[model samples]
Target: MNEPQAIAGVPLRWVGPLRIGGNVATAEVEVPLATYETPLWPSVGRGAKISMLVERGIVATLVDERMTRSVLVTAGDAQTAYLAALEVDARLDELREVVRACGRFTELIGFRHEVTGNLLFLRFEFSTGDASGHNMATLAADALLTRILETIPGISYGSISGNYCTDKKATAINGILGRGKNVVTEILVPREVVRDVLHTSARAIAELNVRKNLIGTLLAGGIRSANAHYANMLLGFYLATGQDAANIIEGSQGVTVAEDRDGDLYFSCTLPNLIVGTVGNGKGLDFVEENLRRLGCREAREPGENARRLAVVAAATVLCGELSLLAAQTNPGELMRAHVQLERKNATTKLGG
Candidate 1:
């Protein structure tokens, strides 16, 4: 056999043992993040620290889970494409049967389509248990496409990926229809906790979210997203957890919502594309397996329970880091100063200074 493959050693840390209450998982869990941005460990740590002081901690709700792939087919004309779409729509049960034969874990959930001239883009969505579902979705779509080409009249094959599935790209459709784990996490911080821990008032953070994340992103022409550094936390977490790190592209396209509830703070992060899983491509490595086990993502469970739990905790982690960053930005120079100090300290300590 050949020599063992060498893996890139990104700095990894377990930031939160943040308490999460949801249907998927109800317990305290530490989140692992592997990133070069050293400041994230402490930043998310602060948010996780704040979580424990509150009664409910963080509430993470699992909204939905799906993986999608689109197939491009050609017809004689737009009218032919439209008619072909109806035929395929009417054959949903038959298509599902074809998907069932392809893989046991893959279930054809539903699909949406677009007809452009003689081109038809059929986006097939699937439920792939415990997997990020990239390969599985493609597999199911392949089978479905074959069946379609053989059965549907006047429809010829074009491409498997029609860009409608919107994989790893920033798209409005993913936000509107959703891909991967759709999760929303919320935490209510008391006035004292907000002031003492976050070093900013409830009102300040809320206003900053609207002015910076919302209005700012809009002015910058963002596509269906508004948040500061979601990619930071997501990339870190993805790396540590052995996820398809590129998923962070569409995964980070999420929104942050903050509201001032009188003197208290209500902060939330809605991550509709938090594409993560306890199984599949990256889960086999030794370090990744250990991390998943610690996060309670490796437990014996039902069909999709493990993946669901992973997604819930992932969303909660996003809220922690997002809340902390927004809180820091509410004050001048806090963000930059922390980064400078933490990076310098880490570098010095590493060099044995």
Candidate 2:
């Protein structure tokens, strides 16, 4: 057993419970330590989870490493935070639609509100079970910010652009694209569904397929390289909208798993870092309207956040379909054999076997 190693260097720490792959790993570390110098107001006794990825022999690989960034927002009291949280929730609803179109609709968890100066930083958690939901979530966050700005006259807003969005287009926008805090969107899906049909190598899962053909000339790397395939969600989304294609990087990641349940098989896809806004950017692109229509959503009036929700759903839909195809391929004969056996047994029993 690998004993718990100290988490490098950190002073303030929080010890609590964590669930990994349903396995309880009780370890003590820091409780929302100051990754940045900004003031924080996280609650006590709330649920939290820490995820790490390993490749080759290295124990801690960030897939992509990111430094801490901070922003300032202010909310007068808990009621203000709660109200901002509701606006954030409505924006997330838009994100859900996007992922749903691409994969199966599961559930979403995580919601927080932070205050900096006079600005209010709203955050939420989204789960894109099968498909990548990065672009979907990022856009949703942006839309939420826009909504807040429209409603609240006195409050200004900014975002913490570290792991989520730091690309050229994102830079053009104000602050960053995430929820202006240490935001994380974790995905969970069953693994039994996507084993033999698709490549499971770690390198392959990270590649972004959607951007390979469109960005500049054909790039040397393929979508299956190091969390690159996540770009597909962004590519499809950007083409539909007029978004700066670069911001997609701030909110993109992909993960896959295979599971065996008794005699059955299942598969899952997890996408985190979906950064988006509700009312601002990318609501008027011609193709965006078309894509929204395909997903049974209206493109008119504040479609930014709605677009984000739909994008996540679409990614989930894609994932679910991919898993279905793989599952069918692995067990081609089982469906037929099971039916035939059942019929024969019924016939024999009818004759008083």
Candidate 3:
């Protein structure tokens, strides 16, 4: 065995002149994805082409955004814990001041708590600008914990992260309360487009989505998710753009809604936990920084704006791939055939590209 230092390279390709229309951004932009699934490029490209043909091409709306960190403390008993929780709730203004003292781009958005026996879990949420709020929320939580211990008596510190923050885990709380950028991407495909581009009817895709995505997932005990391979697209985009790729664990917890509107097809993906940022630890690499810059996430803008745009684009990318995959599955053998075809090329090729 030999210890060596080198950067790992994955096959990268820019897919989609994806047309996006929404509050955050409106443009036809090229998206870069790095993955071994070569079929994904064309799959997403098919959806992107449909986007351009449609009217409201991938209407990506950024609904809500926040980063959370929870701290655990102990009290004498449940009664003592209840009183202390209320007391802390009353002095939220004071806690905000504590956060302001240390954080410039992070804003305290208040908190929620869960008390069990003598243990108290205080989950603090914040609006972290531009950068993902993992480190930033932890830093502010550290300051808040000190003030809390000093002000409120009989409450002792347990751990800074009580797992209530639920970072990178596929918990239902993050799906409901949201841990990162919450983006919903949708596109309306005309009957002709569905027939021409997808070679399937809106009825077929919508029925397949219900039977396979919803019921099949429920049968398999999937939590807060109803989609095909959201992780595949998230990983490709995250790896290409320098995100904490593990966040996809929770980020993949999303829903795919499909409906046949008379004859047209309305498809949407609601991703509540899209944990990505333009400026972060992994973003400093030469290729990563360049990719971010090219993706228009590196521009000078208002705090949190760049990250929001990035999140919107990322959500739209997921939609493109998800829509394509689901549509392909409407017809039997298309999905596996395409995957085998592409993977065979990747295997035979010299570089696994």
Candidate No. with top TM-score? 1
- For residues 230-269, write the lDDT of model 2, one tens digit per residue: 4544444443433445545543434344444442333344
* 2 or 3, greater by TM-score: 3
For model 1, which pairs clash?
none
lDDT (Cα, tens digit) per residue for candidate 1, span 1-353: 66558889898988877989966778988899998999999999999999888989999998888999999999999999999999999999999999999889999988899999899999999999999899999999999999999999999999989999989999999999999999999999999999999999999998999999999999999999999988988899889888898999999999999999998999989999988888887788999999999998888899889999988888888889999999999999999999999999999999999
| TM per prediction | 0.98, 0.32, 0.97
Give a tens-digit lDDT track for model 3, residues 27-136. Answer: 88899999987898999899889998987799999999999999999999998888889989999999998898877888899699999999999999999899988999
Prediction-by-prediction clash tally: 0, 88, 0
TM-score of 1: 0.98
What is the Cα-based lDDT of residue 134 in candidate 3? 92
Q: What lDDT would candidate 1 get against the real structure?
A: 0.91
Order by lDDT, highest first:
3, 1, 2
Q: Give lDDT per model, in order.
A: 0.91, 0.35, 0.92
RMSD of each: 1.2, 22.2, 2.3
Over 4 Å off, model 1: 1-4
